[model samples]
Target chain A: MINTILCIILAILMISIGGKRGIKSFISLCLNFILLIFTFYLIACGFNSVIVTLLGTIMFSYFILFYVNGRNIKTKISFVSVIIVLILLTFFISLITYISKISGFGEESLEEINMFSYNVNINMTNITVSLILISLIGAIVDASIAISSALYEVYENNPNLNRYELFISGMNIGKSILGTTTNTLLFAYLAEFMTLIVWFNGLNSSFSYIINSKVFASEFIKIILVNIGSITIIPITAILTANKLKNTKE
Target chain B: MSKFSIQRKDIVIFTIILILSTISLVFVNNNFKFYTSTIVKINSIEEEKIDPITEPNILGIEEDYYLQKITGTIMNGKDKGKIISLENERSTSNVVDEKYKKGDYVFVSGNDITGLKRDVYIIIVIVIFIFLLFIIGKFKGLLSIVSVVFNTIIFCIGIKLYTNGLNIILLILIESIIFTIISLILTNGVNKNTLSAIISVIASMLVLSIMILLIAGITKYKNVNFNGMSFLTVPPEAIFTAELLIGGLGAIMDVCITITSSIKELIDKDNNIETRALIKSSRNIGKDIMGTMINVLFFTYLSGCLPIFVLSLRNGVSLTNYIQANFSLELTRFLVGSIGIVLAIPISSLISIKFYKRGDAR
Candidate 1:
């Protein structure tokens, strides 16, 4: 309660100083709060991993991308592509979970869970996959948006351009964005856990196992999925949606 | 007469596929966590030298480090804030941080910018600068500020309400709505434009939500492993179904804003633009945005997980242990959020199309 009051006061103060930007910041704060709750709700419901994963993703799309703002292709496309990726990425997750057998967060987590009286299915491998995937979601979306917007702006400016021309334009834009976008995700992942990565370096571990092992392999698969999901969908979805919407008008 | 109508068959087919995918995701996710063993290790002993500069942190970072010259405020340590020398650490660097001294008051943790040998302040000064910039930007900044703070509070309270155990879907549904309203109100202001955007975002979020739940149920992925998440507070990713929840949160907002803004802009561009033409044009816009939007999520999630992989290359954590001890949060964030980004593209486009066409036909 006190924190809420403080938040309110601070928000008002920011509004006085910054106005619109301050308002945005304040909204971000609230949206994050609701997102946090939705997360908990999933956990509280006996660990239904699949449901939670899906719920979390949609909630993220709604809050982070749209903030339920005005109608724009920017928001709509993001939601659609994100959901589709959610469905498609399952293949990699399943494969990772199957090989890891580190279900319910490995032996350490299982031991703890055994002590509890919860009915939730605690699969460490699956749960860990969730975290890895979540982290990648942000950069992937950002990159996708940047590419799509750049392409459409081009097409909008040059409506006389042929479909082939438009697609080429999109690919050209996509290529430039791709390099940094990939780096962005890669760096973001590394930065967030640089210390832990450093810790892993000091540990007595193997290269082959690190690459092929469930943890490494799973994350590897996830990163690949995110990369592919973001980069792949941007052009294809953009083109198709553009084409369909275009054909309809003509 | 029914010229604007979507083909019933197409809608049915799309809906079926969506529902099926949702079911599949659930089944796959539930029973698939009992296999892999791998851990990426790290080893390092290199130091790079950069110019020394005093940095400060006030907000928007992982660790608890704020701006203060401790000359008068150092509770325990000796070299409080007295012209301390900066150290040379890692990825972080020292830049002119005027906000701490000039403005208000921030950490990535450790002496990333400063060395450990001498007292060093962890640098989230960049983030603090960002916060200061927000305060300086005024109204627009205030709106953003409102969003940041507002979202944080909603997240916390929502967590409590969920823990106390409310109707699960209701918690999500209500929060989504409130989130939409607040976001629009804050960013676009109280107007017709804001109202329209709010509606589109809500609609798009809802459809995507249905797809996610459907897939989770079908896939039956067991979501266990909720403990000892390495983070500043609680690893929201690991708590509850955090991976999916937070994973999808940012993307949802991204899509909502895009779709609404595009539609509003198109409508504003030419109020007489026919409904069909408006939808098509915006969708073309969506295509461009979708590509980049998807990548945004990719970077956000994948970047968060990169450190482990890099460290693995540097040191030698066992593959088995690396995946086991780590990799949960990062991987999930990527996949789920990516999925949401994909789904959002079509849903928002479709809704917006219907919306503008309605206005045009009238």
Candidate 2:
């Protein structure tokens, strides 16, 4: 019932925004949503989530960068490059972090194991790795895109600007957005776990005990690792875009 | 003034908030109905069970389960400072449950049986979080903390409303809007750029929610089984919608603000830049941001659902059944929220274009 009311409000907002563009945006998003569902269905069919995620990332890039941005080759190249770099970065980081071993820290639903049939053999470790990889993809993509697009704009606005100048411009934009983007991640984590935090407070757990708790330790490590991944993307995207744009212009 | 002056001011503010928060903590602890207990001594330890299948432990003392008799002093409540005895259950799989040693403090209810062992830990974690935020973000950090407090209050109210039999979806939607407005205004201040971001955020949420409702309706809501969540009393659909609304709000707002502020910068750089060009620039920016924004939503949802994923997979559940039973809700949220993010790019860009074009014309 509330969904119907919100849809009405959305319709009014979309129409006011410009019926054509608004409708187009809505359709594009719907299609993207469908693609995501399709990816999961493929995973359910025994396909690897890592590969499915990569393919989905490629399709999503095509949709948002190429289709939505009117088939701009420059934007497409920048986005795809950043995604490639991000995937590589995540691979090496995950290897060193040993993030998978600790991934099973917060399984509160273990008591319900008997509820489901357990005949099929599935690799829990691989799935955990894939889950972490999938999680990092969003932040990496956001950072890379932010840097690449800002640099792209710098290049577009000033055809005569050199590589160094564009790189600096991208860095400046990145530095400003970094705080908020990181906060966005922080708050996102906090919002999800507020109740857990409240429960902890109600229990009056000490700081040492709280940090040592399996659930808290796991989430804390994830937040830190993701922040590192995001911060790394900024310079990599900036340099890559600067280099790409420089070569393209020449 | 200088940077040092600002640092000093921040430190002062942090100290004040810390004091106030500590005072409130004491007030809550004293006022609330809690049975406080402290560890006194270990009475005895006995092996209970090594394996459920085997009735006798042929291996003897090396058995898996151990029951410890822990005697403690009641620090508060009707049995204030009285000696008490409790059993602490320890298992080989310590990951599932913890064993408290001597000198530990715990909070027990009226029955004095079910008690939380580490109640003070969370308060320390929160204090550290606030301190770090203030040290890093300074004034903006302070404002972010305020915004978080407001959001928590609003969330509590929404939960109260839901429990009281109010329309959960409506409450969530209203809560989300209020949260977005307050967060934006606090973070970015009241300005044209913030307004554009706000509109974009609302538009994205609306689009995502509508699509989800349509899809849910079409599928007859088969995949959304909320039976697994033992705590839920309302319809699973409402809870699911509420989760999506709250889960997607942060990333959507993040994307919208990035696009809006970036476009605003471009316009300020060149006042006469055409609306067509401005819109193109914003879309380009959106493309760069879309992957990470979507991933942010994806990761947040994934992390929360990881335990269930692991539990199901470890139990040798079939991939298809696991996906159906455990992952459908998370997948719906991540995808629908991703769509909102994707749409927010264009919506924010277009809104900024209109705002900028009008400002330039005037």
Candidate 3:
């Protein structure tokens, strides 16, 4: 009941304050939500989880960049950077998920699932990769777009700046945003598991045990990986945006 | 020549980080004896399928599953250097269990496989993250790392206090204040810009809290599901509210800092700039950040809930039940945090306007 009220309030707030762009953002958000649902439904219906996730993430980036923010030199460059980062991080995420064997539900959730059938015929490891990818796309898209647009503005104001200067300026802008971006990722991820941490505390779990525990390991790994994605995108976007902008001028 | 020198410095930093990461990775992988849990390295595994759906179930969705006879050598504990054999069973789904392979490390006690050894993989990722921070941010990266550590310590302290019977709402209020001060000061330093960001963050958070309170009062906290936290002994609503407070802090801080810093830049560029221009530019900056900032919040929260949502749906959970039992809390969280993000824009702009005028009045 309260959820409806909150949604209504949020929609009203966004549309009223944000105007046309706000309405576009709202639509994109709703579409993204529907896309996620459709992706999961496909995965449950026995499609390859990773492939579906890859396609879903692409659509997500497209919606966020083109549909919501619109296409331009900045969005184009950002979309390229986001894809590059996604590809690179995919390998890392898959490698870590496989090697760490942190796939599947944590032991703490074991009790909760006792009522459900376990023979769902899906590779939980692949699902882990998918979730990590989805968790990461938002911050990476945000950071890359921020860099590309900010750098575009620099290029607009002072067309004489070379690729190196633009690249450095992009890096500087990245530095200013990096701290708060990391904080955003950290706090957001950690907030999701506040209850679990409290549960650990209540159980008087030792520090070493908590760190090594499957549930804590999974959540902590996701947090670090997301932070890594957001961080690495900065330099990559800076370089890519610089080279792209510089070459176009000639 | 200067650009080349900058590139040289970057390469030097990259090399140092690369060497450090490799060393750390090697050290962590071999440090099994450091753990108190009995660790075993699987040497081989033999698997056989258990067929014939003998027992009927509600879902009636049975498939070929595996039963494994796993043999391994103990890497740690008193049974070190001894061979051990254990039996494991896994569904093809493997939702809560994993199939063990050769060269894998598993935690064991006697004959039962307890868990997997995962600390080494975690160490690898953390080292790489720190390396990137240093490579990109240089000294500020190091300071941000320090702030992260300090903030984590503060978090542990907060958890400790919560377990020791402190009021969670009050505790979180204090913690958020400390978090803002420490984070802004450490990353941004103590200056008017940082000061204004801090003021804006706290003020916006206060306004958000009041707004949430009013809404919760109107609705009487109805339909806010705490089923996801059934293990809690304390009031789940208080924890939920506290989570809402900290959840919004990051984006709020991002929006506040971006606006204030942009305003500060404009003021520094033209000290004689009029309030109208300042407001205009600040709103433009806010507009640029607002969409992405909200997207960041949306996706971050949604990721955590996706797996559970999928899992429940696959297991024949009705959509309404899933929404009531699991997603309501998530929706509330996302909505409230986003509202905080949006609210921060104008509040920070207004506060920043006043802040600059008072400090720079001549």
Best by DockQ: 3
Specify the highest-lDDT model's number: 3
True-structure Cα RMSD, model 1: 21.9
Deviating ranges (above 4 Å) for candidate 3:
B1-27, B52-59, B217-220, B318-321
Tens digits of per-residue lDDT for model 2, B1-362: 01213566766887897897797567534432432343232233333443432222221212255565667676655666677777656554332434555555555444343333333434433555555555444566567657767876777666666666788668877887898898899888899888888888888778766766666666655645454443332345656656666766777788788888889889889978877788778766665556445546655565455445544544455657765666655556566565566667777788778877887777
Candidate 1 lDDT by residue in tens digits, A97-202: 3443322222212332232222122333444455545554655456445555666677678778666666556555554444334333432332233322222333
TM-score of chain A of 1: 0.72
**Worst ten in a row by lDDT for model 3 chain B:** B52-61
DockQ measured for candidate 1: 0.06
Residue A227 lDDT, candidate 3, scale 0-100: 87
| Candidate 2 lDDT over residue span A39-104, tens digit each | 555553446656766676567665666665565545665576657665775575455333223433
Rank ordering of all candidates by TM-score, starting from the highest:
3, 2, 1
**TM-scores across all candidates?**
0.42, 0.65, 0.94
lDDT of each residue in A31-144, candidate 3, tens digit only:
887887788778766678888988888889988999878889889988888988888989999999888877788777766666676656667888889889988888999999
The model with the greater DockQ, 1 or 3, is 3
Candidate 3 lDDT over B228-250, as tens digits, reads: 77777677787888888888887
Q: After superposition, how far is residue B166 of candidate 2 from its true place, in Å?
A: 2.6
What does the TM-score come to for chain B in model 3?
A: 0.91
Cα RMSD for candidates in order: 21.9, 8.9, 2.4
